[model samples]
Target: MGVGEFSYRISISTLIVVFPLLFVFRLAQGQLHVVGSLQPVVAGPGDDVILPCQVEPAFNVAGLTVEWSKPDLRPDPNDRLSRVDYVHLYRDAHEVPDMKLPSYIGRTALFTDSLREGNISLRITNVTQEDEGRYRCFIPKLKSQTRFSIVRLIVDPSLTETVTTKAQLDPENFHVPDLNEEIDNKGGSSERCRLIPVVVLCVFILLCFAVGGCLITESQKAELKKRPI
Candidate 1:
């Protein structure tokens, strides 16, 4: 097998051992999902919390599927497509596929930036006190491959709510250098360029001095011999 296939087999082998315990935890809570699970996202009543629905070790993931739903509310096996209540108003998403989605999309929203990357997390905006229930996320990478996670939503009944900035929308922080250090670095670079020609000229002068000294010494010796002193 190729490296990709070999690695995938090893990975799936390890996951198979751990997946049962993880899925059992989902049963404790009223939640289910397809490929991965959402963290128990918390927010005040009427506020929104964006669940980070993502895959581990970002693979060559293309053509995967994601959706959200409630526990005990799986989609029908007959339909290739299903409808959701969030896309509509307060209707049931039985018309939509349930096996590949997280539970609680009615009051929840999902990050729709690039569905190809398999980010199927839901964002429950305007969180209501009634939404303090179990939420789940599911992703199906292949027909036989899937993952699931669940989050228990809790809302403090008496508190006021505020909006949260989208995690993906936060700005980057750029580091700045000290002014004196920056100036010294630039000065040192220029000095090195200037010193190259100076060094060359000094070497040329030393060579000319050696040649001239030899000629003068020969002349002095000739003069002494001619004077016979």
Candidate 2:
């Protein structure tokens, strides 16, 4: 074959091999799944906790809509509106307050920093016993086989009780003077007081010695005067 013809065949073969690889890579990348913890997440009442959920193969989901809901939660039958309420709703780079459940209105949030890393975990602040249940994390626009994950939350009241008991029993909570330390402080003050009299006595003794020396010197001068011619 001519050099030009051989080069043309080589290019065709390279494209054939490279195109399949590119297609397979794209397919695999699109198959990202939403994953959640298999174990139940435990927390104490009045504590802040995060229900872990993330997308596998890590795709940036910052612009996408995320829905967090309780699957078993039933709609309010008394309300005429047939809309489904969610625990938390995020869309268009902001949260939708109107779509959130009334109880979770101010207590639920998503980590803005982790959104770019495909972490869609929901944070619940001041968790209560009423907040214990299964949570669903979903990405509606995700092109994946599994676009949702379930996370179970458990609020243990005993944990909070234990914490309160510990706080009540903690010695640092109250100031109590040590008996030995108080005794030592009083002894130190008495010792200092006892040294004052000794100091005054030493001063008085020194003054007496000075006066006696002056008197002796005067007597010696008189004797010298009497002996002179």
lDDT score, candidate 1, position 13: 49
Candidate 2 has an lDDT of: 0.68
What is the lDDT of every predicted structure here?
0.44, 0.68
Tens-digit lDDT string for candidate 1 (115-170)? 44545556667766766655444443332222444445667766667786223411
Residue 43 error, candidate 1, Å = 1.5
Candidate 1 differs from the real structure by a C-alpha RMSD in angstroms, to one decimal, of: 26.8
Q: lDDT tens digits, residues 1-229, model 2?
A: 4446545755665565556556655565455666776667787888888777887767899999999988777657898787668899999999999988899989988988989998888888888899998777878888654567667788888775222111121222222122222211211112233244456555555655665565556656766777859
Per-model TM-score versus the true fold: 0.39, 0.58
Runs in model 2 deviating more than 4 A are 1-26, 76-80, 161-229
Candidate 1 residue-wise lDDT at 162: 72
| lDDT score of residue 187 within candidate 1 | 13
How much is the lDDT of residue 33 in candidate 2? 66
